[model samples]
Target: MSSSFDKFQKRRLISSYFSVVLSVFLVLFLLGILGFFIINSKKLADDFKEKIAMTVFFKSEANDSILKAFGGELKTAKFAKSYDYVSKEAAAKQHTDIIGEDFLTFLGENPLQNSFDIHLKADFVINDSIEKIEAGLRKNIMISDIVYDKQLVNLVNNNIKKVSMWILITSIFLTIIAVLLINSSLRLSIHSNRFIIKTMQMVGATKSFIRKPFVMRSVKLGMIGAGLAILALIGVLVYLEVNFPDLGILDDKLLIGIVLIVVFGLGILITWLSTYFATQRFLNLRTDDLY
Candidate 1:
């Protein structure tokens, strides 16, 4: 009966350890999903910002050569990404296409100024940066006015900032929750070994010596859990890519690699810390308390 009881206890311990690993896997899996959404959202935001263009209209007195020179100069500027020059005729045609009539004929001549639409680099798409660029451009006599959707710029930047802040707050909150949950699971698993800890202590085992084995076990569990979670994350990513190829979120190899590394690191760190503390608690307990 005593031998059977010991065998049963060993089986229960193995079961409890597996449960802890599964719990950790679930927690890390959730974090991985959140990371995927965050990375894609940032990529989309940069693409949106990079597409915003400022139309620099030239003065009528400014010849084609002058407008052409401005375009060439913009290419050398760090802030400018790319540009398209629209001749007066092309601008008039565009306006006519929109209005469904020949506006130049009504005005008796082509009143539309030759302009170039300049796309700013992603980092320079903010209101403050555009204001500075506009001020510098104003120094040129041949330039008439710069036109862009100021309200759109304001809306996009403001929304991006809010979304970023929320993501950051959410990430932090989830991380704390992850630690608590993983720690709790690990504590329960360690609780089964409380008697073992006390026995080691009574036998003159140094705390470090007793703690080392448990910590190593925790590390092994964490690596296995993290690996399973990463596999699940990869599976989800593959499913999404296969079913909805247009999303293109999984295209960023470097970001995906970083996220996986983070998941793996978090799993190991949280488990190790929890195991170390949990073992310490049992070490302080009386041998009778193991019952």
Candidate 2:
């Protein structure tokens, strides 16, 4: 009967620890998902902004040599992400293909002029920055006109700003929830061991001496839970990327690394603090309170 009782108590202890670790893993996994979205949101917005191209038409007098020099200059421009030169003939051909007819035959000559489709970097896509860039581009004598949808630029920026603000707020809210849930789990685990803690205190163990083991054990559980969460998060990302290659969320390796570190850090920090306080609570309780 004595051996059986000892085995039962050991099993109960293992069950309690498993539950605590599982709880931590679930909470941290959800937090990791939010962190990933927050980190990649800006990159997604940038990709959308980069697709809004600005067309720069050149004057008839502007020869290929002048355009080539301008192209070289644009390559080094701070605002420009990329630029593609379209010859008058190429433009005419594209137009004809779009209309499904040879308009050049009827016009008797190609009316289209040389142009460059400039894709600006995300940071320079706003109206004010674009206006400055346009003013600078117009100063070039070879350039005839610059055209882009100003309203569309404004819309994109406005919508992205609203979305980013909401995401930040949501992330903060979810983080608080995760902290509470993890803390509650640790408290419950410590509560189950209250009798043992009181027994240690009665046997003349110092508070620090008694607290050290619980703190260390909780920290180890936290690390294990975090490691499992990280693995699960990575598996989800890999599966998503494999199926939807264009999402590009996994492209920013640095952000992913930061998210993993944050999950692990939060796990260890929250558990250690929670365990310390929880053990301290039991340590201060009266013998009768063990009931």
lDDT of each: 0.91, 0.92
Per-residue lDDT of 1-291 in model 1, one digit per residue for the tens? 999999998999889889889988999999999999898987779778878899999989998788778878998999998999999999989999999999777689988888889999888989899999999999999899989999999999999999999999999999999999999999998987787888889989999999999999998999999999999999999998999886786799999999999999999999999999999989888777778
C-alpha lDDT of residue 255 in model 2: 83
Candidate 2 off by > 4 Å: 1-11, 99-109, 236-258
Count clashing pairs, candidate 2: 0
TM-score of each: 0.74, 0.83
Across residues 1-291, which tens digit of lDDT does each residue of candidate 2 receive?
999999998998898889879988999999999889888888889989999999999999998799999999999999999999999999999998999999988899998889999999999999889999999999999899999989999999999989999988988898888888878888988898898898988899999999999999999999999999999999999998999888886888988999999999988998999999999999999999789
**Per-residue lDDT of 154 in model 1:** 94
Number of clashes in every candidate structure?
Answer: 0, 0
> In angstroms, what RMSD does candidate 2 have relative to the true structure?
3.1
